[model samples]
Target: MEIYVTIKGKVEPDKMAEFNGLFDLMVAGKTGAALETYGEDTFPAAESTLEKVLDKFEAAYDSINLESYTLEQGKLTLNFMGSYALEQILPDLQVWLLACGVKDVELEGNWV
Candidate 1:
């Protein structure tokens, strides 16, 4: 089974830059670039915030893989794919995103 999950939200204004760097790290194959781009001082905290959400998925739902993402104008949309049922993952993901300072979190899932 192929399940697709789309998450939409806004990163708080002050957090957008670091979030963008994180997005680049995740989606653009730019590992460790966020640390350089965001500076060592700011990047660790920013990376930790992103890590909390990823660690949840990794620890509890290892099947899902974040396939892509876009962060622009304070809005973020993350696309994920996996074999797991969407309902099993969405609620915790929504909460994790909220905890990471993403506002107005919304999610949708479909199977293909």
Candidate 2:
């Protein structure tokens, strides 16, 4: 089975790199080390581990005035879908919007 998790948000262009980097790191491996390396002020301490990451991610989405986030958890895999408006604050932010149309699907849900 597979679970899906989606996050949506509007962010400045310059911040897209940071956001995508941190998000990728989280999906790749939501570990303390990973958070410490990619996390920013919005990211919580890694002490709580994946729980903290999820909490922080949720908060971040809320802060960005996101449209919605959907999470589906299954027996074997997890999928994420996110949708948000495009911010014109910076040109770089468009990078993150590349996945706006489709959901991000990760094969495993180690945190779950």
Candidate 3:
């Protein structure tokens, strides 16, 4: 099934640079300094966003394919092909968003 994941969040003015840096690096196929190499407590300070979340899923879950995404007005919509329950991943995604300096984040998933 195809899943349409809508992620709504705001990057504070202070965090916009960090978020943009991470997104740009990920989009450029540059996973700087092996992010996965960092321990739980040693994770880099780069803020997460749509790209980071999708990149994590792509690296960890071969079953999930992120086909497209759009970000506008603090809202991000991700279209992916996967067969997993959103409930299983929502919690972690929420935490990532919070750590990424995103305020009042909201997430929704629909099957179509």
Candidate 4:
């Protein structure tokens, strides 16, 4: 079984450098086992065990189909479907943006 999820968010175009840096970290393959998408547990230091969570997020972000995804101006949208549990990876999407905040998220298909 798999799920299709769409995430949308907003970020200042001026802050793209910071956003891209964080995003690049995820794609670079750093690994973290325990990290939260939001709240106090977010944004651990580079050496912190929780920091590896960025790796997990990058994998999921990379998994997004990208066929219908868009990131331009101040808007960002991504759509992808996979067997991975959304709870396991979806939060990573939100975590990528230090300034861009998620405005909406949609999920389709059945989940277990």
Candidate that would win on TM-score: 1
Ranking by lDDT: 1, 3, 4, 2
lDDT of all predictions, in order shown? Answer: 0.65, 0.36, 0.52, 0.46
For residues 4-111, could you state the per-residue lDDT of candidate 3 as single tens digits? 666667765654555555444444445444333321223344234434554656666632344555455555444434555444555666676576556777766666
Give each prediction's root-mean-square deviation over alpha carbons. 4.5, 13.7, 5.6, 7.3
lDDT of 3 at 73: 55
TM-score, cand. 4 vs. native: 0.43
**Model 4: runs farther than 4 Å from truth?**
17-68, 92-112
Best by lDDT: 1
TM-score of each: 0.64, 0.34, 0.55, 0.43
Descending-TM-score candidate ranking = 1, 3, 4, 2
lDDT, candidate 2, 1-112, per-residue tens: 2222322344455444555555555465553555555443443333234344344445555212222232223111213433331122112222223333112422222222
lDDT of 1 at 51: 54
Candidate 4: 10-residue stretch with minimal lDDT: 31-40
Q: Which 10 successive residues of model 2 have the least lDDT summed?
A: 85-94
Model 3 regions more than 4 Å off:
26-60, 63-81, 85-87
